[model samples]
Target: MLPDQSITEELPKDRKQKRQPHSAYLRRRLMTLTSIIIVSMFALEAAVTAWYDYRAQLANLEKEAYLLADAQRSVLAAAVWNFDFDIINNAVNNLFSMPEIMQVAIRYPDGEVIASAGKLSDGAAQMRITRPLLWDQGGEKEIGTLNVVIDISQVESSMLVKLTERSVTLSATLFICLAAIYLACRWMTQPLEELTAAITRLADGDLEQRIPHTQRNDEIGNVARALVKFSENSRLLYDLQNSLTFNVAEKTRQLKQVREDSAHDNTVRARLLAMVSQEIRSPMTAIQGAVMLCKNGLTGEIQEKTLHMLHVAERNCERMQKLIEVLFDIYQIQNHSLVLTLSPVNLLKLARTQTEIWRNKAYQTSKNLHFESGVAEAWVRGDEKRLQQIIDILLSNAVRHSGKGGEISVHLRREGALISLSVSDNGPGIPKKIRPYLFEGLARSDEACSDSLGSGFSLTLAKGLVELQGGQIYFESIAKEISSNSTLPTGATFYLELPYIPAPEAAD
Candidate 1:
């Protein structure tokens, strides 16, 4: 199956499980933001409350210290003025009875310490206030001094208890607020969760899934509606895709059938051509032999006009015989039945021999056929008859295309591990219109020479024969002047290459 066609297959079990849903991410973000806000609000409230309580407690403590001094001043002054040591001592002891009082002291006017009570340590908390005793109610005369010291430990303990209680309350409120916010967020995002699930199902190829909250008027509802539309569109697309797949498959089967029919037709055509060539060749060979005998005057001397006529008939017969042979060879190649009798042969000598035979023919006309070999000898493994046929085809093409007074050249040389035989002609080059299909059977140029009895079978036969012998054949054409009157470009060179093999050394 095609890669695209396998998309609907089940994904790996681990992959499906590993994918985190969209709702999970949204919930995580919402919880994190809500937690920060709740924590910040609690921290701010606790700080503000602690500051306010601290200031209030300090103010109340200062007021209580002043009030205690004011209430006890008359008692302390009278005791000190009467010179009663017990009364002064009792007054100091009474002041120290209060939990906030850390110490108390009474001093005489002469700077002598009259009384002192309570522990005075290095780390003891103390709030001090001094009041002077007056001799009369006018307070004009100073007699003695009363000093009271208040401890701040008890106040600190009270403030700590209050802060603890407020902290507990704030914690409970934070918990309740967070719970409410989480519930509200979950409720608001429930539609989104449903939409995400529907989309997942759609991706998994379940196009029937529908979002449940599409009727509600919210952003999530709009998304749900869009998801529903998407599911519908997906279903339509899947149907169209299936239809296209079925049509493509049907067309592919039809194409395969057409290809099979064409192959069978080609086979039948090749077989028919082979049978016809075999039938025609036998009688044509006999006719050629009889015509040769008559032309040689085996029976009697012939008239001049009759002899020319006989010669014409003989040549036509030979041409027909050659055509038949070419048709048979083509049929054999198309059927993959052309077998070569391979042997070690000198390629350079072979090329030279074929060139000489064609050179004599070229002399009969006003054409020049030149043969050049760069090496003393070049050897290869090939079928001699088949190789000769290829050379003949190439030379014939060069001669026919060159016309009279034209030049044709054949060259042989060793190139790397291969032997190359090249035939070139300075004629009107192969026409552009027919060059593409030059080696295709029966391909002829638009301006084929009227006097030439050339069929397009020669090059195709040559190419097939060369390839069958493990060789390659190709050609190059250059635009050049063929004549003075017409400067139109024309020239072509055909190349044949075969694997080189060294000939056995002569015995010493």
Candidate 2:
């Protein structure tokens, strides 16, 4: 029933469950702590018990020696009084026969020995108790003394045996208590270790691994139920995320396909328009020539009415030719087959020339054209024709957007390692509704498309051409609704910057 009694009993095979590494480590710590505490208590108790037992054994032996001396004092006194040596020797021998009495002696008061049963031992300690013989029957006169020496060596041997027994019992109890603590720690930590592993699995996205021991009504069970809820939520979120990703990928694929189809359709339409324009151009050119000849009286004299009609025909023919040229240019650019003849061109001269040409055109539209140059000669390497065309587009756009009598300015300047030609107009700034799609070149409204001289892709084509020549183009514009507080201008300023070619490189 006690721990010491059951210490040697073997544990049942079923109760000895295999411990997990975590549980085993925890159990080892618990066992070590329990061992320290229990062993300390055992040591203290054993020391106290041994100390008391040793003292009691020594005291009992000493008490018995004194009592033996007292018992023999009367007889020794009578023997001494009668001068009987035989009785004295017999009593001394009797006292020595007992184990505690190592030696017994009867002696006269002058230290002469009458009788003694034993000599002193070689190493055994002795307690000598002396009792004097008094002949009180006569006049209480002293005759002889009895000396009993107790052998404490016997008490030491007895203490050794008793201490050994106590130590054995306590050691057994300490071991069993430690073993029980170890088992308890292992049992309790097993479920905790399982829960820890389950948490790791869940964190690693192993949502399918079932958490064990959920049915128990304990703290571990509460945690298990909470984990179960978290797992369900995680699974639901994972499913939703997967579904959302699938839908996004599918939508992106559909968008890419649609864009490919649209690009194909645009390519085909550009080719068709180029073909139709080429067909219409020859006849239109011939008609313009014939009308010019008749109006000049080379064929015959013409009335004023016929002359005005011929003038109208010439203007319409020019408009048609310009539209066709724009369409063909758009097609060539779209197919990436547009050829550029690279050369070192004087950018300032080019800007001046284009400004003059557009100045005449702007005059016809009642818009004033102004030109300014910040550098004497700005050189850039590019297709001279394409550069001229880009300037023409910007100038034409300025003229078209400008109100009557609105001032248009063409500025040419050197911008560190580049040459920039900017054209601006003092007209209403770009409209807000088309700002988002402004560069895509869909004018979007009649107000934005006031001049239909260009294809819907004029800005787009200009941007592509600038990039092809290693240049950049950007613009700044305030919509018509906002008033310009700055002194610069109210309309748009489009900048076309090309890599500047040094004069030395140009010469080479």
Candidate 3:
């Protein structure tokens, strides 16, 4: 059997490097990642807790200093008022019992210390607060001032103890989590490793190997169940693969033979069309000339009725000649020999001239034709004769498909590096059934219009000619619905665009 060759290319280049076994990698990767994430989260929490705790300790130091100073200020104020030095000294000395208040002193406003406690070491980091002592028994009067200093250096050490306790607790929790995850990964990967070995053995034509973990209800069990069924169908798949390989080879051979036959048929058909068109053109031209001479009274005097019949015959003969030429062109295109004669041609002029020619034909069918363009010269590099032929096909198709008294219009314009020509008709639009194959070498008719007959590959020829000149052609139409009331225009418009070229004189 042929391998699925694309699988090798579709694998990642990184996968081509030396790699660990899937089972071990799965276990190790899962456990390691889980361990890292748990550790990182715990560490982040510890750091944030330590930061807030440190800030809180410093804030408590400041708040306690103020609180303790406020608590004893009244007693100190009375002591100072009564000129009792011993009571003031005792009140200031009691503040040293609070750990945060490292130093406390009562001083007179003149900077003389009345009483103080807690000696300060030189260059010790501390926070100090000062407040004036006021008498509360009467209107406020400053007797003295109280100052307190708080030790802030020990805040870091206190926070460190808190963070250390949290770290120890988190470390124990993390160890337990990592151990659980490791055990779980081992349990998961063991069965997976067995399944991997089963698949590898199955791939190596060991159809009878056991599939593990089917009794447990999990994805692993589901995989084992599926593998159990796959093992039973292993021989069937092998047989089918051999049959499919044979079928694919047979179908490829048949397809190649069919394409060869189609190419041969196309060649034969093109040659027949060329031979038939050449055979019909000579007699068609003679008949048209004879009809013309008889109508002009050169083949003896003809009656008025005979003259009208001759005109009809002459028109039919002209149409036939056109069909022959169209066939020959189709043959040339099919045989890939439709060579284009490139030159700078004025598209506007060609459209106007063809419109004038088609106007006479339109008038015969009670249809009016109009030509409009803004530019005097719309230049494009193309075969003028082929371009004219494209215009003729578009105009003729418009006139034929339009109802009697319907308006036909030929519009041309130059639009920056491209020239556009459109032929429009206010008739019952192109038929729905044939729209899909409109430009696919199919005969077309607007049966609703009831004023025209359709034959030949006019649209297909127009498409071929337009594309050969480096142009695009398309059409738009909407058929009026029988049951709906709408103001939609039931008409068809054909548009052709060719790459515009600078005028000959402008180029010079």
Among these predictions, the greatest lDDT belongs to: 3
User: Cα miss at 237, model 2 (Å)?
Assistant: 2.6
lDDT, model 1, position 409: 92
What TM-scores do the predictions have? 0.69, 0.67, 0.55
True-vs-predicted CA distance for residue 411, candidate 1, Å:
3.3
Worst 10 residues of 3 by lDDT: 1-10
**Candidate 2 worst ten-residue window by lDDT:** 6-15
Where model 3 places Cα greater than 4 Å from the true spot, the runs are 1-201, 208-230, 250-254, 289-301, 374-376, 446-456, 480-485, 506-508
Residue 493 in model 1: shift from native, Å?
2.5
In what order do the candidates fall by TM-score, top score first? 1, 2, 3
* lDDT (C-alpha) at residue 88 in model 1: 75
Clash tally, candidates in order: 2, 0, 0
List residue ranges in candidate 1 displaced over 4 A: 1-39, 51-157, 206-218, 232-236, 292-304, 373-379, 413-418, 446-454, 478-486, 500-508
lDDT, candidate 2, residue 421?
Answer: 87
- Between which residue pairs do clashes occur in model 2? none
RMSD over all Cα atoms, model 2: 12.2
Which sections of candidate 2 miss by over 4 Å? 1-39, 47-163, 193-212, 289-301, 360-367, 444-451, 455-457, 484-489, 505-508
> What is the overall TM-score of model 3 with all chains considered together?
0.55
Kindly list the per-residue Cα lDDT of model 3 for residues 1-508, writing each as its tens digit.
Answer: 2223223332233234424224644466666787879788978989898999889878877887788888889989999989998888788878888876777888888888988888776766688899899997658988789998887767877787888998898888888887887787787689889999999999999987888887654556656766766676676678889999999999999999999999999899889989999999988888888888899999898999999999889877877787788889988988889999999998887888888888998999899999899788898999999988888888878887787899998888877888989899987777677888988666466473342333437787888888888899999887655313787788889999999877887544
